[model samples]
Structure formats: structure tokens, C-alpha cells
Target: MRREVPLAITFITGFLLIIGFFIPHDPIGGLQSMFLQWYAIIAGFTMVLGLMTLTRIHTRRIVKRTQGFGYSVILIGAMLGTLVVGFYSGIKYKGLFELGTPFMWYYNNILVPLSATMFSLLAFFIASAAYRAFRARTIEATLLLIAGVLVMIGRVPVGNLIWNKLPIIAEWIMNIPQLAAKRGILIGVALGMIATSLRIILGIERTYLK
Candidate 1:
């Protein structure tokens, strides 16, 4: 019954949404909004459940004195601190989680800086990957390497100083080849999604039941 009920709901909801897209009648449209609202409420509860799960896992790690448990301690402490401040400010004090509040202050000063540092590290790793991948071993690889270099240079002011036409060439490459590649990828993704949706609607994709 547990498996059957979820599958039944998936099939019905999938078809209703599909049919609603084509029909656009009042009842179907209203049902879509109602379902979306229900989804939002469910999502909120899921977030709380997720937070509890995180806390449980980290607490277990801390209790067991696992390797790098210090990081888990920091993570749990930060999460609990944020949650407490957010609830206290918003619920008890009738203040908001807005810019001037402690919640936003921690979010902006601590979280944003940490996130920016992570992204900066990511950019360094991306550059390393590009260097390895763009080795001019083949004709295609050479062309790709040249295009990447041109784009990188064109984004900065020195490329214009080096050669005025470099920016124009870079823009052409992006607008023509890059745009075409993106559209092709998008079309493939759309077709794949349609096939997967059909599988779910027909109960062939029952992995979700687990």
C-alpha cells in the first residue's frame, strides 16, 4: 500500500499536469495552483526534517569522536546558532531576518565571505582543469584552446590594447558556436525529461517508491 499509493499519486499528478498544460481550463489551472501550494508546504516540512537529520548525523559523529569531528562540531554550532538567532529575532522580538538583524549580519559577514572564498578556490581548480583539458593534442582541442584563450583575454582590457579585433572575434565565437551548442544541449535535455516523465507516469520508474 505504501508503494502503490505514491505511484498512483505520481501517475495521476503527472497526467493532470500534462493535460492541464494543453487544456488550460479553470479547474485544471486551479488544481495546479493548489498542488503547488501543497508542494511548498511539504517542502517546508522536508527542510525541517533535513535539518534534524543533519543534526543527528553530526551529533553521532561528535559522540563517536570520528576523524575531522571538529568540522562537524563547527557546522552544527553554526547551524544551531543561526536557527536560534533567526527564531529569537523574528518570533520573540517581532524583528525580521532582514539586513540589520543578527541573522542577516551573520549571513552577510560570515556566510557570504566563506561562500566567496569557496568560489575563488573553485575558480582556481577550474583553471587547472582547463589547462589539463585544453592541451593542443588534436585539431579540435587546439581550436577549443584558442577560443578559450581569446575569450579570457577579451573579457579583460589588455586584449583590446593587444589587438582591437580580438574582442570582436571572441564575441563572434560566443554568439555563434557557444549559443548553438547551448541550444543543442537544451533540446537534448528537454527530450530526455519527456521520456523520463512518461516512464514515471507509466510506473516503469518505480525507484522513487524506495
Candidate 2:
């Protein structure tokens, strides 16, 4: 009964949403809005459940003194500290997300810098990957290597000094080939999503229930 009920709900909700997209009338449109609001409320509760699960797992790890327990301890401490500061600021300032609040300060000072550092580290990995991928083992790889080098050079002022048309050539390659490739990928993704959505709506994809 549990499985059947959820499957029925999923089919109804998905079918209604599809209809609402095409026929944006009073009842269907209103139902769509109500469903969206319900989704948001459910999402909020889901996030709370996820937070509780995370805390429980980390607490268990700490209790067991398992390997990497120190990192788990730090994660739990930081999460709790952030939540406390956020709640306190929300009550004191009547807005949790206002500028200059303690939560915002922590976000701006700590979180942003950490995020930047992580992305900066990606540059090295990207360089390594580029080196491996650009090896001229075949005609295609050779062409790709040449194009990459040209694009990189065109982005710098020295490329302009060496050849005046290099930047224009680079821009053409990006606007034509890169944009076409990107559009092809997006079309493929859209088609895949449509197929998956249909499978779920038809109850062929039941793994989500588990």
C-alpha cells in the first residue's frame, strides 16, 4: 500500500504539472502554485532531516574515535556554530541574511575565502588534465592542442603584439565551434531529462521510492 500510494501520487503530480505547462488555466495553474508551495515546505523539512542525519553520523564517528574523527569533529562544530550564529542574528536583527550581521560576516570572511581557495586549487588540476589531453597522439589531438594554444595566446596582450589577427581568430573559434558544441550537449541533456521524466511518470522508474 505504501509503494502504491506514493506511485499514485507521483503519477498524478507529474501528469498535472505537464498539463499545467500546456494549459495555464485557473484550476490547473492554481494547483501548480499550491503544489510548488508544498514542495518548498517539504524541501525545508527534508533539509532539517538531512542535518539531523549528518549530526548523528558524525556524533557516532566521534564516539567511536574512528579514523578521520578529527575532521568530523571540526565539521560538526562548524555546522553548529554557524547555525547558532545565524539563528541569533535572525532574532536580534529581525533578518537572518541582512548585511553586516555575524552570520554574513562569517560567510563573507570564512566561507568565501575557503571557496576561492578550493577553486584556485582546481587550476593545477586543470593544467594537469590539459597537459594529458593535449598530447598530439592523433590528428584530432594535434588540432585540439593547436586550437587550445591559439586560444590561450589570443587571450594575452603578447598575442596581439605578435599577431594582430590572433584575438579575432580565437574569438571566432570560440563563438562558432565552442558554442555549437555547447548547444549539442544541452540538447542531448534535455532529451535525456525528458526520457527520465517520462519513465518516472509512467512508474517504470521505481528506484526513487526505495
Candidate 3:
């Protein structure tokens, strides 16, 4: 009974949202707006569920005194602190986000740098992987190796001294092949998404868990 009601609501709301994009009538538009409002409410409730889960898991870890327990405490403390400060300063006081608030400052300074540092650290790992995989033992590997080396050197002045072809090769590698492959993969993904949507609409897939 608990699951059945939610499932019914899910199906009804989802059907409305999909049909809303096509229908032009005022009644259907109103129905779409109502369903969208319901979806927003559901999303708010789900956010609370996430908060509860975070609190539950962190509280357990702190109580058990497990390894890296301090970091977990820091994670929860930072999250709650930011939430409270942002809520009061922005929503309650300004009725909008305060750009100069400490919460915003910490997000811009600490969070952004930390994320970038993590991503930048990948450069070394990528270099190592590329070193192993781009060996010129085979014809395709040799071609790929040449392309990579050219692109790497092209941005530097020494590449011109080595050969004038490096910059042109790099341009083709970056602009032509990269864009073509990316667009092809994106198109395939879009088609797959459409197929998945159709499957869900016809009840062939039951992945939309309540």
C-alpha cells in the first residue's frame, strides 16, 4: 500500500509532464504547471531525505570513532554551517543569495579550489597512462602518438623550431577529429536517452524507483 500510492502519483505526474510539452490548450497548460509544482515539492522532500541520510551515517561514524571520523565530522559541520548561514543571510535577510556572505566566500575559495586541485591532479595520472598506451609499436598507435606529441609541443615556441607542421597538426587534432568524435558520441547518447524514455513510458523499464 505504501509503495502503490507513490507509484500511482509518479506515473500520473510523469505522464502529465511528457504530454504537457505537446499540448497547447490553457487547461492542459494549467495541468502541467500543477504537476510541475508537485514535482518541486517532491524534490524538496527528497532533499530532506538526503540530509537525513547524511546525518544518520555521519552520526554513526562519530559514535563508533572509526578511521577518518574527524573528516566526517568536518564534512557534516561544514555542510550544516553553510546551510544555516546561507539560509539566514540570503533567504531570511536579503530574500536572495548574498554574494559577499562568508558562505559564498568559502564556496568560491575553498570548494572551488579543492575541486580544481582534484581535477588537476589527474594530469599526472593521464600522462602516465598516455605514456603506456600511446606506444608506436602499431600503425594506429604510431599515428596517435604523432598527433599527441604535435599537440603537446604546438603551444610552445620550440615546436616551430622542431617543425612548422606541429601547430597545423594540433589544430586538426583539437578542432576536427575531437569535435567529430564528441558530436557522434553525443548523438548516440541522445538516441539512447530517447529509447530509454520510450521504454519507461511503455513500462518496459521499472528503473524510476519511488
lDDT per residue (tens digit) for residues 118-145 in model 1: 8899988999999799999999999999
For each candidate in turn, give its C-alpha RMSD to the true structure in angstroms.
1.8, 1.7, 3.1
| 1-210: candidate 3 lDDT, tens digit per residue | 765665666667667778888994678778999878887998999999998999999989999999999988998998888787767677655544467876677778877999999999999999999989998899989988987887889868898789998777788888998789889999999999989876665556766663
Model 2, position 97, has a per-residue lDDT of: 75
lDDT: worst 10-residue window of model 2: 91-100
Q: lDDT of each structure?
A: 0.89, 0.94, 0.82
Q: Is candidate 1 or candidate 3 better by TM-score?
A: 1
| Steric clash pairs (candidate 1) | none
Error of 2 at 73 (Å): 1.3
Cα lDDT over the full model 3: 0.82
Worst 10 contiguous positions by lDDT, candidate 1:
92-101
Backbone steric clashes in candidate 2, count: 0
Best-performing candidate as measured by lDDT:
2
Instruction: Predict model 2's lDDT versus the native.
Output: 0.94
Score candidate 1 by lDDT: 0.89
- Candidate 1 or 3, higher lDDT? 1
